[model samples]
Target: MAFYLVTGGAGFIGSHIVEKLVRRKEKVRILDNFSTGKRENIAPFLEKIELIEGDIRDSGTVTKAVKGVDYILHQAALPSVPRSIKDPVTTNEVNVLGTLNILMAAKELGVKKVVYASSSSVYGETPQLPKMEDMQPSPLSPYALSKL
Candidate 1:
């Protein structure tokens, strides 16, 4: 069984990912600070997976989470646009620096893969339908910039 680490595994999207992994009987581990994540989201399978309650901004915590993991599903972030505008510093620290911590830890520990969840807001408000990856990213908000 491949060891999978889902960061922010208590959040909406993260919880769903955890549920899928659990259904597949994979060895799952969760790293979540629970700042915006709810306990009830992951309550069903709490005992089935290893849980580490910590912030991703801390390198030590990130390293601990990534160690011995095969694939990293990075979903942790301050995902609010208005909140990022209000507090860009914390947003950058959590979204940018926190992601950097995950990347560095994954590389150092020889993890096979690191799957990142990026926001579509990076494209900004374009009238064009069906956003393509090649389009120029015009991030308007601090949150979008951080995701980019």
Candidate 2:
């Protein structure tokens, strides 16, 4: 089985990813601060995965989590536009700086791939219904801009 590290694996989307990975019998490790993630989300499969309760912004924690991992699925972030507006500093610290930490760890550890979960809001408001990836991003909020 392949070993995987899933940051924010206790959150909504991240929890689902953990579920799928566990079902496949992959060895999975979770690193979540639980700022936004709930304990109940991961309660069902606690024994199946390794849990590391920590923040992504901490380089030491991130570096430790990335060790011996085949892939890094970076899903940790402080989400929501309104929340970002209310506290841009916290949002930037978690989203931007946290992501930087993940990238740095993955690069230093020689991990082959890092799958980052970027918000679709990066596409911004446009007349185009099906927001194409090629389109230039025009972020409307601090959260959207950080995702870009």
CA RMSD of each candidate after superposition: 0.8, 1.0
Q: Considering only N, C-alpha and C atoms within 3 Å, which residue pairs clash in candidate 2?
A: none
TM-score of each: 0.97, 0.96
- Cα lDDT of model 1 by residue, 1-148, tens digit: 8999999999999999999999999999999999999999999999999999999999999999999999999999999999999999999999999999999999999999999998889999998889888989999999999988
- The whole-model lDDT of each prediction reads 0.97, 0.93
Residue 3 lDDT, candidate 1, scale 0-100: 96
Pick the lDDT winner. 1
- Provide the lDDT at 129 for model 1: 82
Residue-wise C-alpha lDDT for candidate 2, range 76-146, written one tens digit per residue: 99989999999999999999999999999999999889998988798777788788778889898899989
In candidate 2, stretches whose alpha carbon ends up further than 4 angstroms from where it belongs are: none
